[model samples]
Target: MSHQPLIDGFEFATAGARQKGRWPVRELPRLRDMLASDAGEIAYELEGTRDERGRPGLRLSLQGTLELRCQRCLEPMPFEVGADEVLVLAASQAEIDAEPADAHAPDRVLAGKEMPVRDLIEDQLILELPYAPRHEGCAAGAGQRADERISPFAGLRGLMRGKH
Candidate 1:
């Protein structure tokens, strides 16, 4: 917890400013629901830019480790998060809607006189999270218990083979 950074979107972009900071994981209330434990920190860097098309934008970079619950085993797993995102600032919601729809399009944010750096970072962080967070290799997963596993279809298999 610290002084929340706020900047004028247009002013920052026009001035080509840069800001960086670290936030404790627990402080991001929006992302708390998806986390296994609130015991880590995330570092972020935000830089203002003007695109070739004369559009004001912000580039955000985030790095940190998040503790997520493995969906299968419900065990805590460490997930490394490193993401870079570009957000094009639009004057209004209509301006954003006027743009052609494309899955590969950069995100657009409504330009505001006061934009919170913490909110911007958390928005991107939520998007970076997996739809179903799980460990690639969970110690409590099927692989480690395969020997003791028995299928419900085992009896059917024996009948098919005519074996008691």
Candidate 2:
């Protein structure tokens, strides 16, 4: 949560560094709005490593359960989050900007003197979240009590039965 920079991103990658920890989900201010309740901790591991093609990159792994609001039923539900990503380091923003767009290309982040750990984790989590969260077999009427349910056809059902 502190604004302090964790490490020089380029140096970390070059040195093959490793860092891991369990942080409270509430500490991530940027990710707060996405959660129904920020009541748990997220485990994260960030390592400097090389990709399959021998490209220097950072490997990030996150594991946690998030409390999210089900869009269908508007109820709170637990969603398990597990993500692993390799982010290729570009020498500079200009170099990254000149590259052609390709879906197969690994994600690129400009190497910098200062890279905040919290921001990196938050960015990945934001990208991984579903645009619309939902619980299985849940709908608009999902959590409603039977006594609170209303039917316009209630009166018509008795009328039709009498007519028959």
Clashes of each: 0, 0
Q: Each model's RMSD to truth, in Å? A: 14.4, 16.1
TM-score per prediction, in order, is 0.81, 0.79
Error of 1 at 30 (Å): 0.8
Query: What tens digits encode model 2's per-residue C-alpha lDDT throughout 24-91?
Result: 89999978888899999988988888888887888889999889898777899888889898888777
User: What lDDT does each candidate get?
Assistant: 0.75, 0.73
| Stretch of 10 with least lDDT, candidate 2 | 155-164
On TM-score, the leading prediction is: 1
Give the local distance difference test score of model 2.
0.73
The list of candidate 2 runs beyond 4 A from truth reads 1-5, 139-164
- Candidate 1 yields a Cα-based lDDT of 0.75
> Relative to the unseen true structure, what is the C-alpha lDDT of residue 156 in candidate 2, on a scale of 0 to 100?
35
